[model samples]
Target: MTIAAPTADFLVLPPRPDSTADLLAASARQRGMAVELLSGPVLPDRLRHATGAHLRGGPVFAGAVAEDLDLVLLEPDDDWLTRLPYEYTHRDITLTTLGEARWSRTPMFVKPPRDKSLTACVYADGSRLPGDADHPADTPVLVSEIVTFLVEYRLFVLDGTVHAASRYATHGRLDPAPLDACPHRAAVLDFAAGLLDTCGDSLPSAVVVDVGLASDADRGTEHWAVVEANMAWFSTSYAADPDRVLDVVLRAAGPRDRLAVRDRAFVRPHAAVG
Candidate 1:
């Protein structure tokens, strides 16, 4: 059943909006779209029962709201990163259940593949992993060899192209700058272009792909490698253009029926219903 697009575009925001969401809402309004800043986490009756609603927020709120609404939440597959070429990842990585990760003997960066259910950081050993009582042992997690990134940039991609980019961090610190003004813009965009040309099909039409220059001590050279992919709706705009970021978010979380057939596979599992 295909649902027609509403003549008026509507964007739903959480009650306590963050800087990024506020910027997106402002952009949406500038485009003449309706903005509904919620009174709480709960969606108002008007939107709760309406069709063709678009939203932007954290994963928890999006997940909860998606359960009853026919929303399209785009996200890469849980194992999408592990499946990428070694050239792009530049680190040994594996996708396994938490129970399996509990047996790790060496330090590794571990995190839930698509959610913040687990803290994402390097752990000394498997003993540090939460017990079965906390989260299910079967929960999927990504374990990777630790690598240091000198500088990190986030690319807002749409239709296999880098729509906008910004330097969000440097040496593990928050140091943001618009890509256009950054010295590394050309290299960052070029590296990202190569990556997308090879593996763009693995992601949704709209997404956030982080990349960084990693120190390879053994090779005595620094090179770029992918950091991770995130749902556009839940990602920060940083110094990227708000209008461009809003364009991606709107499509990333718009009505399910409007989703292109090619992107059907990239829809978040929780949003599979609609």
Candidate 2:
């Protein structure tokens, strides 16, 4: 069955919208959808009664709104990278509790599995891992061996196909560019296609996948590898076509009741578990 287009009549944005949010709001207005920018922390009743709506923002705000609006937020599994084949991941990755990860004695790239509660970066050692003052010790986290990415691109996928793409970074810095205009465009698309063809079913139909040309210090070579998967609604459009990105975002977070049975497991829970 084909993915159904969202029936949303309103597009929601957080207070003090960012450039990306402004771009999306413009795109939504162009599509004849009403846009609502929250004035404060409170969600207005008009939005609560809207027939249909889609939101774009950080996970914390999205989670709060999802509970009241009954929106479905789709995100990759906590162990998504660890479960991938070595050919795609190109490095060792482990999914474990923050407490367990703290036992490591070597440098590793450690990050929260699905949230930004903890800063994602290379920790000197397990001793460098932060204490569980803000988050619980059992929170899921992904720890991977360090690898240098020469260039990184973001693909907005819809129904297992790349709907739009943009080169989001180069050498760990923000350098947004249209993928179609970049020399590595073809290579990026090719790699994304192979990855999707191999394990697209493991992801939500509408999601964001980052791929990059990574440098192997030991082998003195460069190759494409999957960076990570993210919820389309929470991903920036960069130089990608905002219209196309919106199409994916709409499907990624819409009415929970319209969600496909297969994607139920991918939904972000309305409430956080302590």
Q: Residue by residue across 215-249, what tens digits does model 1's lDDT show?
A: 98888999999999988998989999999999899
* lDDT (C-alpha, whole model) for all candidates: 0.87, 0.85
Q: After superposition, how far is residue 74 of candidate 2 from its true place, in Å?
A: 0.9
lDDT of model 1 at position 146:
97
Question: Which stretch of 10 consecutive residues in model 2 shows the poorest summed lDDT?
Answer: 1-10
The regions of model 1 sitting more than 4 angstroms off are: 1-7, 271-274
- Model 1 Cα displacement at 171 (Å)? 0.7
- Indicate the worst ten consecutive residues by lDDT in candidate 1: 1-10
Going through the candidates in order, what is the number of backbone clashes in each? Answer: 0, 0
Give model 1 RMSD, 1 decimal. 3.8
lDDT of 2 by residue, 62-143 (tens): 8667766777888888889988889898999989988998899999999887677889889999888878588678978899
Q: Each candidate: RMSD to true structure?
A: 3.8, 4.8
Candidate 2 to truth, TM: 0.93
